[model samples]
Target: MTALHPPGARERHALVVRGGWDGHQPVETTDAFIPFLEDHGFDVRVEESTAVYADERVMGGIDLIVQVNTMSTIEDEEFAGLQRAVLNGTGMGGWHGGIADSYRNNADYLHMIGGQFAHHASKPPEERTGGQSDNYIPYTVHITELGTTHPITAGVDDFELVTEQYWVLSDEYNDVLATTTQEARPFDAWNRPVTAPAIWIRQWGKGRIFVSAPGHRLEVVQNPSVRTIIERGLLWAAR
Candidate 1:
């Protein structure tokens, strides 16, 4: 086993806790950004359990937390400790369910993060020349006028992507950077279009919070625009 922080000249400390439902490819998804973080001067510590959040000694020293776990349970102590760390200026960031959909029963976690994954908009199966995938829909993300000036989305153009269109339950507190629209489908009765945040930032006391609704799939996370947004978000969120 490796110590949380190995002896070296590492400037920043990042703890990546990845575990939970594998449908999201937690390990593989987190792997995509590990190299990028390391190359950018962070000593990354990867763990497969949420217990790391309970270690106050370790949590206190961490400069950032990159979680990839989805729909997992976290104890109160663990959640509290994690919250304290972020409140004290340790940055927290993640994508998809890792941060948004995680700990569905924990309201503190949700409030701190400023949003929760409500559901993915359902799309009717498409009739194509070949075949179609279930629950996956194609949509375009529009960078908000505000996003054009935010460091995380600056210079990044609106782009089209094929994945789950996450309809997040967000609040006014979030500094929304980007958004996507969900058009009404035959099966659903909303009868109108709804727009949701695709990327956002929040503040927890002295800490910085960043969340991107991409990363449902490795391919989505690998998209040039998506990846760039995530990379910049991480850097911006780090303490």
Candidate 2:
């Protein structure tokens, strides 16, 4: 897909805040995007902490904020500055636990993110063998009708992947782009089906927010389809 901003346009600044639980590979996953963002004409700045958000001038100057911190706490002042920045039109985007499952205790943060991780379906501990890894599940993600025409998802076909399928607590405010079906699993045995949004975008004040729920593993992030969706989403969310 073509970039939303043409070459030779003024450079857009992007800030990537990464750090929290190491299990999320915050640094590694976020590092994968620095070059991509730079190649797309963004002046990228990566920080290992949210302290940058406390500086109003810095936050105000940024065009996009890609946060990859998982399960971390944000100071009141820092979060307030971020809130003001986005409200003033700094776009925000991230995937999986980075954005969706972060700052668990911060209700205001969750409100801006539009969703929070509920759980990942996994086999009951008792049913698992030693060293078994049953948390990963294979699933298919279908692009919604709206996605067919949405800039971030246009021309992207439905794809299959095996990863941690997250069931999130989401709001109707999100413009859902794609979805996955959660069928009965031994982890939470029940004869029913539930649908969860796999990719979505929304507006907060003048800013745009984009999220994808399939980036738990490096392979997932490296997948052609997933990478394309995210790359486009970043551009779409930029100011």
Candidate 3:
């Protein structure tokens, strides 16, 4: 529980925009960290729509934006304001589909975030339980050499999770911190194994962007390793 802002530091504001497909449990997931942000000295504000992204006066004062909306549409004006805020140095961060799989039609959003959720490798048909759990595969999240030294991932050891393993489409602009490799099993289509970034950060103008692909639910968000990385990432990304 290290304080992000020391005593005497100016008060900072954090905006949490949450909603969209409920399957991702966006509300619950973001709720898990609001207290953390408050404890760290942020004046936390919660919004249920992406409309707030369009409020320039509000966006301008924000120190950080934690978006938890999944598979939702954003108005062009809203998207523009968000882009402007980040470009001017307001940090942004989120986990799982809340950030990665959001605004599917917005290429600019994808380019800004530096990654998109391509797919979630599923279990074989016989093993499927006929629900979202079908993609709950046990896998390891390997900390890269760079992750070991980055503030967001420093000292966090490689860990395992039984959850949706995201196949992310990302570019070199991302400073990858952690990765997960999808094995080429007999049932899978790809012949060779594919590795996707499980966690990463990017510099967008003066703002910093942090993303973690492992938080598919509240339980996953509460994982010690996952929780720690996200907390540190939030502070590290803040303006």
Q: Which RMSD values do the candidates have, in order?
A: 4.1, 2.5, 1.4
Residue by residue across 1-239, what tens digits does model 2's lDDT show?
34545767998999999888786788888888888898778889999999999999899899999988888999999999999999999999998999998898789999998989987776556756643156776789999999999989999999998778888889999999999888885546656888889999989999999999988856778899999999899889999
lDDT of each: 0.89, 0.88, 0.94
Tens-digit per-residue lDDT, 95-138, candidate 3:
99999999998999999999999989999979998899999999
If the candidates were sorted by their TM-score against the true structure, best first, what order would they fall in?
Answer: 3, 2, 1
In angstroms, what RMSD does candidate 2 have relative to the true structure?
2.5
Clash totals for all candidate models: 0, 0, 0
Greater lDDT among 1 and 2 belongs to: 1
Stretches off by above 4 angstroms in model 1 are 1-10, 125-132
Off by over 4 Å in 3: 1-4
Q: Against the true structure, what is each candidate's TM-score?
A: 0.92, 0.93, 0.97
| Order of quality (lDDT) | 3, 1, 2
